[model samples]
Target: MLVTIVSLWAQKLFRLDEPQPFGGAELQLTLLAKALVKRFGVEVQFITRGQGPFEIFEVDGIRVYKLAYRDFPPARTILGSWDLLRLLLSLKTDIYVQRGGGIETGIVGMASRMKNKPFLFMTSHSWDVDGTHEKNRGWIYGTLYMTGLRRAAGIVTQIQNQHDLLWHNYGRESLVLPSAHEIPAPIPIKKEGVMWVSRCETWKCPHVFLRLAEALPDLRFTMVCPQANSRELFLEISQKAAALNNVTFLPGIPFEETEPLFATHRLFINTSEKEGYPNTFVQAFKWGTPVVSLHVDPDAILSTRELGVCANGDETALRNAVKQMYCDEGWWKKYSENARSYANATHNVQVIVEKFYSLLQSLKK
Candidate 1:
């Protein structure tokens, strides 16, 4: 008699879909899901809440299931959890992953535990781990959020500092999983204007980019501001950009379009006061564009790897770095090359995705 062994396959589901007014977390989710399906043959699904009719759709090879909710926030979280729990049970998801810190994460965390399935939390921003975001600081809010974080079967952090912060503040251990980037194909570098892309939030400091554009009237500066939680700030920046001749403002486009956009620009500028291993920096490197950042460097890669100039949030230093990169072509070329080389070796999607897959498999045991 011959006996054959049957292999069991698992399906992973993300608790949220690519958010509207998309940001790094949404982009990361989309990329990771695509990589999982294309490279590893893993089945992936995204659960999204909407105010319209419930529907299911597919985008870039991932399944998206939409559930309708009536109200926002407090009620949404309560109702959304119920709907999500029902879907989780019916689909029998092997593992559930929450991409960011939110009240819903706690709800899902508890549901996963009750169902005896593994749940993982991935931190996308520094504030997610450190509780520095204003919303995370409230007593009741912090307690509820931390409860879910603590119950998670595993947590993933993009950098060592974030892992350290999680352990120090919440006593939660997390695996250090760096963000991945898709390197663009060989294309002629345009070497033109300075580019900035971010939400028009006060913390992001879009005004700093405007200031730099004013200082460097001879060089062209372009900014892409996407709609985010703060519309007033977005309008404020849009009005500010209108008054400057050297500066051009473009509405945010989809993530797929960002690589070519970055490739056309000679330099990338980051004026954000806080970050958690920004996806923008990784993309800038992959596009062969060097970064000039005000603050937030992960593991000192900017200085040690010679990827770009990191001023550690100093205004004068940021201005000087921009001037130097704008004026000196030879220096900019060297930094740009270093950026691509470093990103290729470190942020390659295949390598990072493989690491993520291993972590998922390990959690199964």
Candidate 2:
């Protein structure tokens, strides 16, 4: 089987040289591509823009062809639909996959439909809470996505939460493919303290975690962010952490380096103001680390998932939850086990790939 991906924005936004460059969705893509090539021995090629033309990379015995898209300035194909269809015909791909309709998917889905190609889109972005852009750009981009989803051959997402939310709001139904990663077996278990995987931005609400650090001085805090913003915003956060000695502000790490670092922390924290769903919950759990999160959504990660506790409402409630994680070792062990089990069940690679592969088979007829 052959899969051709239509994604330009994912390549651009995620390829930044900052912390948390690729969230859970991007990581899910990399893992899926690698596995499809190596384990399943399928032909996989990705369509992208800006990184120059088509080039091939071999990693872990898997082949990846990056077809760099270059098109007109007015913009025909800037949104991705026509140009991607052109690529699909030229490549003779059996299936055309779109990773959300942000900007690129809009292009890809349109192209796929025009050509009568099997179009499958994976909705990884959390549309409800972890929404992007302001009004003007958001509407432009959102319009593109809504249109794309409506015309897609089929749709997929990591968890039922995001999928259900999409169905509730837009009435779009997509297959639930639990996002998975190739978690590395640790060389050494370094249980230092607690850590957070998020960008230091307005929506993420990193300050809430800093407040927790303030209320609990003894515990160490290791926070990572790749989407760095302006100097003013950086300084404001720095000022908040100036007096605190236990907080370690680490820059974003690449996708290749995330797992080992995740293994070292005893617990992972999510203080996001909103989230579509998160990759950190899976990564932290893959390494047997428990998670503690502010009430974002019950779908992403939760107490029942065995990942950790979820607190809703105010900042004080979040703080109290963190203190309990440290004090209750027995409870922590139970949660740690739950995290691993949940991660394994939801994110099993073979299971979801078969789900995707089957959809393509059905679409062909």
Best by lDDT: 1
Q: What is the C-alpha lDDT profile of model 1 across 1-365, one tens digit per residue?
A: 00000000001123333234556776676677778888887777776655466767776667777677545666665676677667766665677777777665666677677777777788988889877533546664566567668778899998899899999988889999878877767945567889999877788999999998988889999899976667788898899999999988986766666777788888899989888888899989988898999997787888888888899888899989989987898998999999989888888898998988887777753
Off by over 4 Å in 1: 1-19, 69-74, 133-136
TM-score of each: 0.89, 0.83
Q: What lDDT is reached at residue 269 by model 2? A: 83
Deviation of model 2 at 352, angstroms: 2.8
RMSD, model 1, all Cα superposed?
A: 5.5
> Which residue pairs collide, candidate 1?
294-313
- Candidate 2 lDDT for residue 237: 76
**Each model's lDDT:** 0.76, 0.66
- Compared with the true structure, what per-residue lDDT tens digits does model 2 show for residues 188-234? 44476778877667778778878888778899987776555555666
| lDDT at 325, model 2 | 74
